[model samples]
Each structure stands twice: as C-alpha cells, then as structure tokens.
Target: MSIVNIIEDLNPWDKKLHGLFQRQSTEKLTLIFTTRENLDKNSRLRNELFQRYSVPEYIWAKVCLRLQGYFGAEDIFSEDGSTVESHVTWFHFEIKYPFRLPKNKDRAVAEHQPPTPAQKDGKKPAGYAWYKMGVVTSWKAPDQHTIIFFDAEDSPAVGVRNELKCNCENVKVEPALRNPYWAHQFLLGPILACYDEAVWNLRDHVKALEQGRREGKHTVTNSLDSNDRDLNESSTTFNALHEILRHALHKTEILGVAIQTLNSICARKKIFEEERYSAETVAKEETVQNMVITKRCARKIAVYLDFQLSIVRSLEARARANEARIRSEITLAFSTVAQLDSRVQAEIGHAARADSYTMVKIAAVTMLFLPPSFIAAIFSTTFFEFTPPEGEKVSKDFWVFWAVSIPLTIIVFVGLYPGNRGLSVRKHISSAAHHKATTVGPTVASPAAPAANMV
Candidate 1:
C-alpha cells in the first residue's frame, strides 16, 4: 500500500493548496508535493514558462508585456529596439531591460542530460538521494492503511493553511496552490512518457515470446525435400521466444542502472523547503519541522527507487531493441525469401524451356522423315514401280536411316539435362539470426557516481 507519489507544483494554486486537497472526503494515504527553485530555498523562480523555447525573444516579450500590464502600463522598447528586464521587478509602467542579448543565444543550448550524481571529491553528497515528501495531515490512516503512511512532510513548500483562503466564487481569485515556476501540464506529458515507456516495455516481452513461437512453427514446417517432409525441423519460434525472454532480462538490468542514475541525482530536480533558508542543504539539516529521517530507510528508499527506475528503463529499451532487431531480421528474411522466390521462378522457366526444346527437336525430325515413311509404305503395299536402288531395295534401306535417327534423339535429351543444371543448384534461405540481453547497473564511469557538490 506504500505508494510513492512524485508531484511537482506548477502554478501558485497547486503550489499552495495541494497539501490541503482532501477531496470531497478525507480517507487517503499521505500526500507529499515537492518543488524546486532558481533562488533561495523559499523564493523559487516561481513561474518559468520558457525552458525549451528555441527562440525565447517573442515569448519573453509577451512576458514583459504582461508584467508591464500587471503594473498597469505599457512595455518600453530600447533605443536599438532590443530589450532588458528585472529578475522579479514590477514595472509601474513600460520598463525595459538595459542589457543586450548575446548573439547566437538561440542556438546555444545543450542536450538534456539527466541529472548526474552530486559529488565532493569522488564521493556522493554526504547526504545522498535527496527528494521531498509530504504527509497530508487532514487525512489519517485507518486500520492497515497505516502501512501506506509516510510520516514525512507532504511537500517542502510550507504555507498551506494560509494560502487556501480565497473564496471559490471570486472570478479573479488566486489559485489555492498553483506553482509559480514550471507549468504542470507541460511536465505531465514527459513524466507520463517515462512511466509509459517502462510499463509498456514490461508488457511487450510476452508479445515477443509469442512472435518467436510463431516463427519457430513455420521454420519446422518448411523442411526442404522432394516430399517437402523432413526427418527433423530446425530453428523454431519457441527457441526465439526464449531468446526474447533472455533479452527482456537484459532490458530489466539496464533500467536498473538508469534508475540508480536518476535517484543519485534526484536532489537536482527540486525540493521546496518548509523553513526559509538560503540553500536547500541547510534547510534539510536545520529544520525542526516535520522532516524525512535519513537513516537506513533513506538508503533503502534510494536503492528501491533507483532500481525501479532502472528496471523500467532497461525493459523499455530492451523491448525497443528487440523490436528493431526482430524487424530487421524479418526484413532481411523477407529479402532472402525474395531471392528464393526468384530461384523458384527460374526453375519453372527452365522446365518449360526444356519441354519446348525437346518437342521442337522431336517434331522437326518426325516431319522431316514422315513423307518418306509414307511413300515407302505405299509402294510396298501396292506393288507399284517404286523399285530397289542398285543392289538394295528402298524398304530394306530404311533400317540404315533409323540408326542415324536414334543418336539424334539421345543427343536432344542429354543437351536438355545439361542446360537445366542451374535448377539443381541448392536453394537455401538464410537460416540464422541472433540478438540477446545484457547486464546493467552502476558502472565505473557512470555519471551517477557523485563527483563534487554544487551548492
């Protein structure tokens, strides 16, 4: 029943009221929300809507315009028509930032690498695997429900009771708990993507097994012989399915490594503190407020979350690799089979040509001698003037002609057989394809192995 919920506060309402959300009733497990900031622990860079924008100028201008409007005035433009602004300054009227933007600022960005372990020397933070949690106080654990309760604060962003004072009826009322920093909707999709990739990977192993089975069955059926039956069939999908299972195991291992990497760097994500402190580390150490006890349990939690993340990631990756390999193999097999098909067609063509050639040879020979055979038969039966030549009669000389005819017939069949030798060359489709799983976990060069701490 212990469910670890990772909720990010996006708007001021979500930031303020998430802990106070007791649904219509109040019987649920502990709810903890965590947040990160660009400033001191309490003062987070509240509303950051432009994380992934390639060109932030247009959007930043809109933001500047909105800020100016918030103060009831027009936004100012610079003499060069460039821009400037405050960190969190309110413009009573049109206020422009005095500085110029860097050239190539649009193209200057890095690929998003997952947070690596925070380190000092070669060791991870003395306090490692930091993430925030909250225990929703309005609700209580009932019966065995206590098993699910995490005694930690539900969120590091502290002021809950005071923030929920706005009436629901007001049109312009500030939200009960909207985070000022990042928007939840945007993050929602990515978070779900991570979860989904993990879950779906676990599920596809079954399908891979099934596909391997089907492939195996077909291979056995296709034993090449005159009767098309074999003493034994080799290479079945059943074997392939087992191979897929083995691969799934590898994927699981890879995921474990990824999870560990993620957990080691969890602190980088964000953690809004309950007590106002200059930095997060100080807040965690100094607070007498509801705190997460760092002991054996913390390590266990870190290990567990890391492993889970890794397993999911590895499986998902394995599933994809397996799929790609399977597809490539199938496509290659198809290509091989295509060559087989061509050979088969050629065999058909050769057989047809042999038959036609044999017939042509026979028919031409038969037509050549048919008139003589008919003339000889007519003279012998009618006792007419078709007489013998020199010492030999026409009928008696016919035996001489047949001797020549027999050799010609033998030559035709022999020529035909030799011409058809290409058909006898063995037709073989490729019989082997292979891929499998591999181990995954902490590595010697893994980024998760904390190096130095960044305050």
Candidate 2:
C-alpha cells in the first residue's frame, strides 16, 4: 500500500496524459478510453495513469526504478487486511555470474610479481565477480492485478516476457476467468522458465568442468608414464573451475530462496481464500471456484519448486566430484615434480664425485714429479759439482742436460693431463688404420693387432 514516486519530475510544458477513467453519477455512468499514442511522456501524467488504473504501489516503484538496488532487498512479500484483500511478492533472479574482464591496464599490472601494496590490501582486482540484478514484482489488489518485470540489459527477463505473451495467447477462457488464468500462467510459466534456463546453464557449466577433469586425469596418467608434463595449465583450469562452481552454488542458493518465497505466497493465498469462503457454501459458488483454482495453482508451483531443488542438488554433487578430481590431479602433479627433482639431485651428486676423483689424480701426479724436479734443479745449479768419475772432468756442456730435461718435462706434462694422452693415442691409431686401408683397398679389415699394440 506504500507509494513512492521514482521517476524524475516532469517539464511544465508537457501535455496531460490520457487514460481509462470511469465515473458513476446519480443517474448515469461515464467511461473514457485513451489510446497509446495519446499517452504523455511526462512523469506527472504517467503517475496519474498508474493511479487511474489502480496499479499497486510496489509494482509502480519496481518498474519505474528498473529494478535497481533490488539484489539484497528484504521483506519482499507482504499481506495486509484481515480478509487478505491484498498481497505483493517481489523476486530477484540472476542467470549468470557477472565476471568482469581484465582491462589492458589491469593485465599489465598483473605481470608484476609480489603484487603492489594496494593489491595486497584485499581490494578486489579488476576481473573480480560482479552481480547482475533483475526483479519480478506481482501485486494482487481487491479488483486489480499487476505484474511488472524490470531486468538488466543482458538479463533473461525479456525472454520471460515473450514466453508470458505466448502463454496468454494459448489459454482459452471466459472474461470472468481471464485475470485469474493469466495470473496463474504468469506465476508458473515464464517465472519457472527463467529458473529452468538458469539451472540448465549451471548443469552445462558443471559438465564442462567434468570434461576438464577427465582431460586432467589423462594428462596425469601420461605424465606418470613418461615423466613429462606441464602442470601449470591443468592447475589454472582447476582453479578457474573452482571459482565458477562457487558462483554457480551461490546462484542456486538465491534460486532456492526465490522458490521458497513463491511457495509461501501461494500457500498464504490458498489459506486466505479457504478461510474467507468457509461459511459461504452454495450461495458463493463463484468464490468456491476461484478458491479451487487458486489451490490447484499453488500445488502446481510446489511441484515445480521440488523439481528445481532436485536439480540444484545434482549440480552440487557434480561440483563436489569435480573438486575431488582436481585435488587428486594436483597431488599427482606435485609427486611428478618431486620425482624429477630427486633425479636432478642424483645427477648433481654423481658429477661432484667424478670431479673429486679427477682432483685426487692430479694431486697424486704432482706428488710423484715434484721431488725429482727439485733435485734436478739443485744439481744443475752452478754451485753444485757434477763429477762423472775420478778420470772425467765436470762437463762444461750443461746445455745438453737442459735440453733433455726440458723435453722430458713437456712429455710428462702432456701424458699426465687428464684427456691429452687418450686423444693422442686415438689419433695415431686412426692415422695408421687410414694409411693401411688406403694401401690395401677398402674391402680388407684394418688389423686389430696393430691398433691394440699401439694403444
């Protein structure tokens, strides 16, 4: 019964709006009808039209506001009067999770590691989830009924409106039954269809997650066999699926609340009608018929609500299964990474041991040659007397000894350096084999005895 004007004030120069008006005088009755083309665009005229038609305040406000700020609305359904002469129910529904795409600037910022202080402060990122809002308001007056739908630009409410029109056309009934018939159809048809479409979309999303899980399992199996796979892609897909599932679950919760509200409204209407007509009996056959119709409509709505709940349960179960599968895949990927790490560590250990062995060999060669080299240097010094025998003088040609010692030192160094001796030996053997092969022609096998002796 509360009325609020949500439309902007009208311009003074706008013409008055024309609408249906009825007046009953003492001796005569008058009825005036207006066409759509004659309706004014001014807010005052629009308000007058609504008042004239007896549109409920709630429906008027919802439509005028375009359902804005209705997402978290409370006390959406209310009944008034002892006889339940009036009632209103408003419902909000969203078919999809509104996730914003990251802007180019956001993407560039995301590339930096150890995110900025602002990001670490728990602020929502650019691509975070947003909520779309849509509303359906239904009001039943003593002699008038109104159903107003306000939805976001991308919402399914438009589809529901089209479906409602189709349902209205399909029903055949007398004028007296027209309002009640359309009311019931509006409640059960388009409203139910909206929820049904949302549920179907959720089911499809869950199926996609299941498919991704299967693919992850295959990747895990192949990785176990070959020890080659990139877990990053699988990990990212799993996380994204988890996020989507969470959104889907939230949507289901909202739908459940909406369904419960609808069921409550129907139940209250049924009870009110039965109590209002309890004493009337045969005289109020029309009232009885209306009561019966209301009760049947309530029952049909209850059945649909139960079916929707079942679908929500199924979706939840599938989401849980996918969660478990993703967890197992992640565990397997970690194990594979661990195995690879262990292999790398083992290789490092082997290399370290080989290096230590080479260092030890070099130390041993140095120890074997150091004392002899020191002794030869000492004897070759001018201070040392080198007497070959009693009859021989000390040799004046010390250059001969220098030439021999220098060449011998070079030979020892070339032999003892780790890979030098083996390379030289292999080279000489290959040269000899090639020479033999050229002289004897390519048909004969090079002699193995010569190569072995040379080695």
Candidate 3:
C-alpha cells in the first residue's frame, strides 16, 4: 500500500490510540513535548513532519505501526538506515521495554473469567507483552535544531520532561536545554532506561529460576514417596527454564542492537561535526565544546549499556547451569527407578520358579499315592466282596457307600479349589519371613534344607 494510505489506516495520531495504550498497559505516562522553540510557528518543519519529512516514507510508516501495537519492517532497526545528508542527519531506530498488563477493568474481567486454558494456567491472554518503541529523529545542521518523534513515552522521557519543568527557573538548566548536545543526550535517556529495564527483568528471571532449581533439588532428594511425580515436575521446570532463556537471549540481542545504534549515532555525529566546519568556515569554540560533551555523554551511556550486556550474558550462563543441573537430577531419578524395577523383576522371576517347583512336588506326591489309594478304596467298598462265598457277589448296602463317597468327594474338592487363597498364603509366608529376619539373629540352614527345597 501507499505510505499515505498506510498511515491513514494506522491513524497513529488519533487520541484513541493513546487511550488504547493507557487502557492496555500498566505504565502511566506524561504527555510528550516538543523541545524545539516556537514549534507552532515553524510551519515548514510541521509540513515536513506530516509529509514524511526528509526521512523515508517507510520510516514514518514504521513509527505509525509501532504506535498502533504492530511491528513494521525489520530493516528499519539497522544503523544503515541512519544517514548524514548535506542539510539533515537523521536516525531511524527502535527501543524496546518490558510490558505488563494494567490492573484495570479489563484485568478484573480477566481474573473473573478466563476463556482459554492458557489464561487459566496463569499465562497472559496475549502471548507476549513486549514490542518495539520507535523513534525517528533528525538534526539539521543549518538551523542548529532537532526534530524528533517518539511513538510512546517511557519513564526516562517523562522524567526528563518533568525535570525540565521543575528546573525551568534555573539559569544553568535553561542554557543546557538550548544546546544541541542536550537533544542528543536527551534521546539517549529512553534507550538506556529501556535497556536497563530489560536487563533487570533478565536478572529477576534468573533469580526466580535459581530458586526453582533449589526447590526442585529438594523435591528430587525427598522423592522416595513420589518419584514419578517429582521427576515429571522437574522435567516441566527444566522446559520452562529453557523457554525463558531463549527469550532472554533474544532480548539480549535487541539490547546489543540498541547499543550499536547509539554508537553509530555517536560516530556519525563526530563525522558531521568534523566536516561541518571547513577552513573557509571556522568552527565556533562553544559549538566544538558542546560536540565534545555530547560525545562523552554518549560514550558513558555506551559503557553503561556494555555493563548491562555483560550482566545479561552472565545471567544466561547461570540459567544454563541451572537447566543442566535439573536435567542431571531428572536423569538420576530415572536411573534409580530403573534399578528398583530391575530388582523387583528379578525377585518376581525367582518367586515364579519357586511356585513351579512347589507345583511339581505336589504333582509327584499325588502320582505316588494315587494308585494304592484307589485299590484300597475299591477293596474296602461295601459293593465288593473280595473273598465271599456262593451268592455274595454284591452287598445290599452298596447304595450307602455310593451316597457317602459322592458327597464327601464334592466337599473335599470344593475346599481344595485354588482361588485367591494361594495369594494369601504367599503373603503370609512373606510376612513371617520378614518378621523372622527382623526379630531373630541369622542362623545357618542345614545343607539338607536346600536339597529338600529343590526337591
């Protein structure tokens, strides 16, 4: 789409956009102010600002997009887009800060009724709250003036403006605001503040992770009662830490780019100052001094950012170490569980073999006695007479023998049926062995006992 159409669709300057930002974000901001004197009288600058200025249309489009909560082109973030024209030196860069949900009516609704499973699990309805805060600034050497735009106000911007208001009567502060160096340094405030906050968030996240790791260690150490549950929880913690670290690393990259952008601006400004005055046009001493001061301040800010970057790196290392520690603990828990399972399985195999041996012995005993018992039963039966004379082929009381044998056989078989009764016997035997092992001293078994057990 054309730039004008895009900007119109975005409606960046709409008051409703500010209201939307206020309603959704937890941060309270003061109104953004233009530092240039008589901005209303400068119709040319106003026209330039609204008509894409000397800067690219894409730059304006990006600023508009970020103002409306959408990220524009990635190329806009690069220092390569920064230019030093004959009449104007301008920068197109971005700043990012941590975002939070506002505790407003919307927050109340979210708490009262979560519509999604993720929200119920304490995650934000919107997956992430961080986005780019765009800044488009241009410095005109001819007029010794700057024109800047910020899509949103952060603490640093608000604080700077507030300081300007509070010290308006101070002669010292008034002169500083007029100096071109002040504008350059002023712009650095929000960038540094946002980076500092990003690093702080990283540090706090690392701290929380350390705490969680310690808790996980305690859980793993005392996991004898609930090994599976503890291990699963630890795994989940590790996964969460991994995701956080990934995000932390990404934020660090953004921070690094911010620092780079600052340095690039400083380098270009130095070049502009050096080349702006030629042998024909001598440079003013005050102007030269201001340029030097601006350079120093920028360097100091760079140093501060470098320190924060180091902290972020250290935090990343610490988080990785915690992740590794939790992973090892989980692995150890799994190994312990595996060993216990192996031991139990071995014991089960031994029990199966013992039961098979017992069954074989019982079968052998039944085989040895069954034939003799059968012959004795037949001879003792009243239905048969082994050595009887003439007509004693059968006894009249045979019916009595049949009735008694049938009923007794049914009762005996019923009582001997194998049900859960075997399980109970095995349990009793185990308990008795356990009790004996605990109560009595160990005693040597007879060699014949082993032989008898095998038999």
Candidate 4:
C-alpha cells in the first residue's frame, strides 16, 4: 500500500491512533526516534519534529497496556498479519531483578518529617518497605527497511535509543544502505546490553552460592560441635542456589524467545527473497540494494541471536551443576551430623555399663564380710558369753561356750543356704519362663494323648 493509503487507513486523527500520531505529520511520522536525527541534519528540525510528534501520556499509557497484554497473553514468537504482510516483526521483552529496591532514603526522610499520624502510631509508610519493582514493558517493530522502537519508562529502552542515535551519527553508510544498516544497529544495542547484564548478574550470583557451599562444607568438616549451625548454613546455601537456578532458567527462557523471534524474521526474508529481487528493474537499483542490505542485516541478527542462545544455555548448565553440588553438600552435612550423634550415644552407653560393673563388685565385697560379722554378734550375746567373770582368769564354761558357738554358727550358715537356694531357684524360674515366652513356640498335646491311648 502507498504511504497515503496506509495513513488514510490508519486514520491518525482517530482517538486510538491520535495519541500515537499527534506529534508529527502523517508523512514524516517515523516510530524510530534515532533514525529521524540521521534523516534530518538540522538539530532544530529534528527537535521540532520530535516535539510535534511526541506521544501524549494517554496514548503512551494505551501503548503500554497493549504491549503488556500482548506479552502476557501470547507466545513470544507468535506472528500477526501485519508482520507477515509488511515484513515487519514485533517483539516484547522484559528484564527483572530478584531483589527488592532499596528504600528511597530521601522519600523516607520526607515522609518522616513532623511524623505523620501513621508514624505516630508506630506504622511505617503505606508503600512497600523493600520495594520490588521492574521496568515498564518494551516493544520493537523491526520492519524491512525501518526499525521502530516504542518509547518506554525503562532504562534499557532509553539506553538503546541513545546508543542508536550515537551509532547512526558516527557510522558512514551509502545512502541506499543507510536505513538497513542503522535498523540492525538499533535492534542490536539493547539486546546485547541486556544479555550482557543478565550474564554478569547470573555469574555473580552463582559464584556467591558456590562460595557459600564451600564455606559450609569447611565448617562441617572442621567442627562437629555445632550441628545445628552447620545445617543452617547448608540450608541457606541450598536456598540461594535454588534462587540462582530460577533466575538462570528465566534468563534462558527469554533468550530462547528472542532467538525464535529472530528466526521467524529470517524465515520470512528467505521466503520473500526471490520475489523481492525479481521486481527490481534498472529504474529501482537503490530499492533493490536496500532490500539486499535488509536481508543481509536480518541474517546477521539471527546469527547473533543464536550465539546468545548458546551463552544462555551454558549459564543454565552452570546453574544446574551448582544446584547439584549444593544438594550433595546438604546430604553430606546431614550424614555427618547423624554419625556424630551415634558416636556420642555409644560413649554414653559404655559409661553406664562401667558404672553397673563397679556397683556389682562393691555388692560382692559387702556380702563376703556379712556372714563372719553375723557369727561374732550371735556368740557375744548373753546366752553364749565367754568373757571372764569378776577378775577370774578364765570361765569354766569357756570350752562349752566355744563348742556351742562353733556348732550354732555352722547350723546358722546351713539354715541360710536353703533360703538363698530358694531365692536363686525362683530367680532362675522367672528368667527361664521369660526366655521361653519370648523364644519358644506353643506345643500341642493332642497327638501325644492319641498315641498313648492307642498303646
């Protein structure tokens, strides 16, 4: 379709399109801000056009909403009719950080000034204490000869625009190839920057987690004194590794989507290659060259995306390895703690057995002296006294006393034997019954009785 027809069909004045188109004339309205600077040498003219075409807040909001919905609801590589027909591909990407934003010190100070009523009640500000935030959605349309990047509130988008403007100004290109070359340059800058940042962050996080695992292993090895501390350290390291793996996986997913999008673009270029060149005539040499340039640039982009995918895959592999290492460390820590506990319990049991043996020896010594002491006490009693009477040298009944004492002592010892034997027998019987109950099977007497009756 002709430019006029496209504009008329688009209806720039319409409510939906007005915010997007309001800032510039329909004929000169290029989505690419960087290219406009190259197309116009005069800084004044570029500024004037930018001011005139600057999208209104309402339109910007709508654009953001559309981008969010498209990204959230559709596959990253899915194509629309606009992409197929016009040889334009639309892509959306996001960069996220796992950590929360540090609270804005200035904002915090301002809120605390004079102590707001909520502060008086000991409550903090209404917003998040540790703000978890991310950049706005970024969208790009890489057309056959023109690449348009929608402005967003994201730092990456801003960085891309600035880099593209600088590259466009510095690079000297033939008039025929300028658009095609710059389009690739524009698309490459943001993607590469983001990819590099993701790789750096992932590497650092993985390194930290690995370091923690090493430290935890060292602690477990050196000191068995604090099992709880060692286990806690291992748990922390494991959790960190899990987080890193999650981040790495997310990065790989985005990389894959990007690679797929570039592949789709390359596939379209290949399909239209013949038709694109066949239409070229002597009158359209410049147009033919531009198409050729665009095709070559698209191929380069696809190759770069493939390289990035490989890098991302490597990062994912590293993360997986770290995860496995952390898991192994956790298992080792648990095993070490268990073994230590078992050893401690065994030592306590040995100590208890030693104490029991000492008590048994003391009881044996006490029993050895008890019989003699009992005999002496019995003889010294009034009934069998052997002490001299009044100053007499000896008692007449001393021999009788000795004879009676010896016999009585022997009799007492004999009498005690039956009681001791009975007690011993009772103990043996109880032990035997217990052993039988524990180990022996019940016996059936019916077969024996039947055999006896037959005999």
lDDT, model 2, position 352: 99
Off by over 4 Å in 1: 1-216, 219-268, 271-304, 362-455
- Report the lDDT tens digits of candidate 4 across residue range 259-316: 5544554454445444434554213433656667765655675566466546545644
Query: Of the pair 2 and 4, which is ahead by TM-score?
Result: 4
Cα lDDT of all candidates, in order? 0.33, 0.45, 0.44, 0.44
RMSD of each: 25.5, 18.6, 15.1, 12.9
Q: Tens digits of per-residue lDDT for model 3 on 214-255? A: 675544333444456767865665565555555555565555
Model 3 misplacement above 4 A: 1-53, 61-128, 141-144, 153-181, 215-228, 283-455
Model 4: residues >4 Å from true position, as ranges? 1-20, 23-85, 98-151, 155-158, 168-185, 212-222, 227-242, 245-302, 314-455
Clashing residue pairs in candidate 4, if any?
Answer: 23-52, 23-53, 24-53
Q: What lDDT, from 0 to 1, does candidate 3 have?
A: 0.44
Q: Is candidate 1 or candidate 3 better by lDDT?
A: 3
Q: Which runs of model 2 end up more than 4 angstroms from their true locations? A: 1-82, 97-133, 141-144, 152-155, 171-297, 308-455
TM-score of each: 0.29, 0.47, 0.45, 0.47
Task: Output the TM-score of candidate 1.
Answer: 0.29
- Choose 1 or 2, whichever is better by lDDT: 2
